[model samples]
Target: MWPASMPGSILHTAEVPAFDPRTGQLSLASHDLISAPLSLADVFPPEYTLLFDPSPSRPYGTSTSAADADQPAGQSRRKRRRLARPDETASPLDWIRHREKEATRSSTDKESDEHHAAIEAELGTAVEAVRAGWMGKGEDAWMGESKGRYEWREKEDEDVKEELDLVGLGERFAPALDEPPEPLLLSESRSTVSAAALFHRIVRNDGSSCISLDIEVDASEATPTSKATVILPPSSGFLLSQLATWPASAPSIASLGGEKGGWDVLIVDPPWPNASATRSSSYDTFDPYDLWKLDLPTMLGDSPTLVAFWLTNRVKFRRLLKDKLFPAWRIQQSAEWYWIKIASETGEPVWPLDAKHRRCYEGVLLGYYVPLGTKVDLPTLPQNKVFLSTPIGHSRKPFILDLLRPYLLPRDRPPNVLELFARMTLQGSFRRSATDEDGEGDQQKPGIFLAVGNEAIKFNIVDGSAAAGSVRGWLRRQEDTERVCAAEEAV
Candidate 1:
């Protein structure tokens, strides 16, 4: 079983400043320069010296009153007032400082309120759009099933939970396991395959028990495998060999037919560690620095690459994305969009817009990877757009294919897509499948490749062939389904 939180075994100890959920604020030992509001003195310095408390006990500085007794010990308690110049009065200096503080506070408050209001309005509009016959017919049915399963899991008795101990299970049961020499291919026409097949394939072919597969459509001679999904185990040697042929600056795209070029669109949802995730024990989290270790820049194509990063609302996480992660990947930040979660029943935010603990929305940070000296024409991505939807489960993001389809490069042919740290398969069907039908059931040609850790293989694999037709059609059907469900939910 996947660890409830990022496995304790992984290196998750990255020190981020603690935050207070009650106040929706960070608890910093010292003020963060990035988050601090700009002031007139910040832009144009005064000639006179000003002495104020360094501690942020108050907005301007530490209070001079008896409130110092309530503050923690060792903190600076020496109260100092702003010094006046020989030409200026003390009252004038005090007024200037007070005005600057008030201006900063006003700017911060206005930005915060506007952000909250935008979330509310966008969420409400999306809900109304679904209600106005925009949802697909089968969309709500599938959603209902998923919602039911989620509810059941939540209501299930904790004592009755089945625990699978994987620590030593593999070594104990399968001592002679070896890495598979070739990839495992499963077909619907062939006998049904299961996790047992994965094990057998690994042992028979001398492949690693912890191998992850890349799914592709088999265009060879017609058989049970014709147009069927072929799962290829990731080969480090194969990848390195292919990378050797490409220019050092360009991304190496993996082809189904073993051709050149790299993934055109990359979607990454890093498992950023957080306090809520730790408390819930629902999924694992990773240290922010570990994200830099991912060789994402090596996976891009020669063309301009569009990369979308799912980000948390935390200030530290956003800072890491803008400051470190984007720069390390050689991708420039282009746009930041909000994914606002609405109520399935009321169309309002699932949480209040001003909720202190959990905000109603998350962020999608979009960036582009432009190879040096390469000028590629790319579509402009709108900044600060809001995508409203009722989320399915914890950490599960709404499908954004329809939202981002227009902005993809090489509009003629299908774009090659890859998802990193993927929890579920990215089938073109726009619906999460319950079983591994492969890609046979999809109406659209499959172009997405998924890579995840071995522990995550328990979930369904990608069915490249299953994703058929245009994304617009799937989105229309989804809206129709949501519309019907919303009506029922309101009733």
Candidate 2:
């Protein structure tokens, strides 16, 4: 049974300071802005005893230890046959067999060629626009001529090391399930939804007991327990609910501001399908066309709304965003940015600028929604900019509030923000991760509404280590200003 001290209501409400309209800048008061590169383990520590490394160092098509053994017999046998082939060469029979299969598959797949050509045409136009704008920016530009070759072993080694560290942590902190876990109280006056209320249990899956949220559990009957308590920083505020619940919840969230109507910023990171993602069995992927059906435009406020989309590099997906999705949403493409994955050790790209198989960067498409006949002066958005960072965990992108601050609406107070398909929870009062080593204290605060699927709630808690060394420069400048103010007061 849970303690009576825990709130009975699933939702808690707290008054947060409104964004200062004069600045048009995002408040990072709740976020630890220390600019240090963090390891994958630092951002998302091993919560369960079983740690599974999805990306292994095995040769292409070869099965790793983590590969599912229960695959169909035919598939397993096929993979085994491929593995049994000689390293440097294939038998003439094997070559002939592969050629026959390819020929048969190609002959039957005529529609694929037409689809590829259509996507290629759309991609070529977008790339040409980018090249035209960045042509004179010189070699220092992100789109500068690439050498077209890379050595990816270092990055792979780093991934392996991080994976091992997670495994070690899991082994060290394996939870005991013989007895009921103790209930943990996470108290914060500003948190509208407590972490205790959001997560029901840490269950083991495939050997590891990572932090998992049982959203299916009835909130009224839930008696959740956590291994640790998390007190959130002041600037954090989150609403924990399934993505389907947002339409019902948005009106209430908007009503909090009386006349705000809807959100000023909408950020979405949909789990778009890809061949690599399909193979890994990570999160469930959705069809790109299904995105067009979402009633996203209805959530936009009367004022100009900023919409940022995290996009995969597939040409077909890009076309869907530009042609189908944007048109349906009535959003005009303003600019595009790249999230470049760099090495934590050397600060260089994990893969070279032009890796043939995989590029080291992902795309972010930014757009704005404007109602008809609404004329407003907006800041010119920079094009083709690169945001550099070492990625942590699967598909966990960098937090770009600092980079996005400049372009946010300059209303009287900070623009209200909203995130769809959100993984990371940003709310008033940021919570420290159990694995955080810096002993960073919490601050009370507020943020925008977040809507995600049930599976995404596990990543909603704050990760203090994500910014580690990355924010030090910015933090130092802030401290220097404070020191000068203190010295002046003393005089």
Candidate 3:
């Protein structure tokens, strides 16, 4: 339903008021600010482990012998314990019970009758019997039952209390009678706009409507522990095989040639379509977007906002964005940032290095053009640069949330930001990951997480050999040796 008080001309902005039917109050819902939880595992899961050499500065002594390496020199390192596969027949608690019983049987109590009485009274039923494993079997069994029953009762009561507390919190935070109306899910449902509206808005040159071509797509289902390929929506009956035969609805890949839009802010990362003969060679030589062909006109679709597009330093790709892509998108160039890519192998100062390894940073293209009639808060560009030194995989885009801070809403409260085809995790931003990495798998350690940011920048030497220059490097090498020991143990 169209908002009762909305002006038909501007439906996208929050400046337009929406009325609540329940309370009869006017309110605003801005789509700009999004709330996304900061987590990697939500989008991507680890499928397999990849090993890379640690930086030379930090070195761990590698050993040939397992026994010597496991207990290296002065440091007493606990061997990485490999967990056994669970038993299907019995519950885990049963195994705990078995261990406890065995421990009780073997344990010795060296105490007077007064101490023994205190221990028995304090330990309670099962624990007391377990402690008195030196005692008779009947006594142990009787005490175990008593302790077990008490524990169960206590746990049940705690659960009941927690449930009641949650109910109370729910009541306290309930919406007031005069609250504004919740937003309808326009993206998923109640969408009035269609491809036809977009097509009419762009194709204004000649009135002869072209035939639309149909393309079939098949979405693949991901396994519990695997990455999945996405299938685009299947083609309708509209069929045109060759690019030349493409109808008005579907422009040819060639004609997808840039026709820029008039936008206040623009963010684009054109996939400089580059072909490759082999898959392995593609990462270093081929354009990252070689496979994903995008239509510039279709992508812009009359968006009037600040525009920024990610680009590489590749001569052809750089030239395409500067000369063709930017012009086609109708974005006025404003600023550029060099993302100095550094590998750990290049050593300390994270900068461009060619002697050890060819390293380069990404070039972020920022551009904007004043809208003829649009009112927007022009963002102030940052003079100071930010350096994110972590080694990311190829084509792993920088966090827009981190980079586009200058172009944010000037509000005390958190601003709403939306990400399209985003993969890396962000805090408090609405996200739609085309290929998400949830930071799952063996990397998600129980007590420690993979540290990044300031903490990562500040080096700390863990208790280890001085001969081994860096502790982190040592730990990583130890991880491999531990893996071998685990394999042998399994055998």
Model 3: lDDT to the true structure: 0.28
Worst 10 residues of 1 by lDDT: 31-40
* Model 3 stretches astray by more than 4 angstroms: 1-267, 270-303, 343-357, 369-372, 375-377, 383-386, 409-491
Error of 3 at 356 (Å): 10
**Would you list the C-alpha lDDT of every candidate in the order shown?**
0.41, 0.43, 0.28
**Model 3 over residues 172-273: C-alpha lDDT tens digits?**
333333321221111221122222121111111111111111111122241111111111111101111111111222232212112211222223433334
Ranking by lDDT: 2, 1, 3
* RMSD from true fold, candidate 1: 20.2
lDDT of 2 by residue, 1-491 (tens): 11111111001111222233347753321111111122111222222111112222222333435555556767665554453432335567666766665567543243434533433433333333433443444332331111211011223333222111111222333333422232233332322433334432211111111222212211232222222112222222344333444555444444432343346677788888877778876565776676655666555645577888998876566667877778777777456666655443333455544333455667788888776678877775655544554454477665555456667667544345566676544332122223223444322222333334334333433211222221100011223334645897999
Instruction: Report how far residue 249 has shifted in candidate 2, in Å.
Output: 3.4
Question: Candidate 1 at residue 205, lDDT?
Answer: 12
Residue by residue across 412-474, what tens digits does model 1's lDDT show? 344555555554332221211222135333222333343333222222222121133101000
Alpha-carbon deviation at 288 in model 1, angstroms: 0.6
**Highest lDDT model number:** 2
Model 1 local distance difference test score: 0.41
Positional deviation of 39 in candidate 2, in angstroms?
A: 14
Give the runs in model 2 whose Cα sits over 4 Å from its true position.
Answer: 1-235, 253-262, 427-457, 460-491
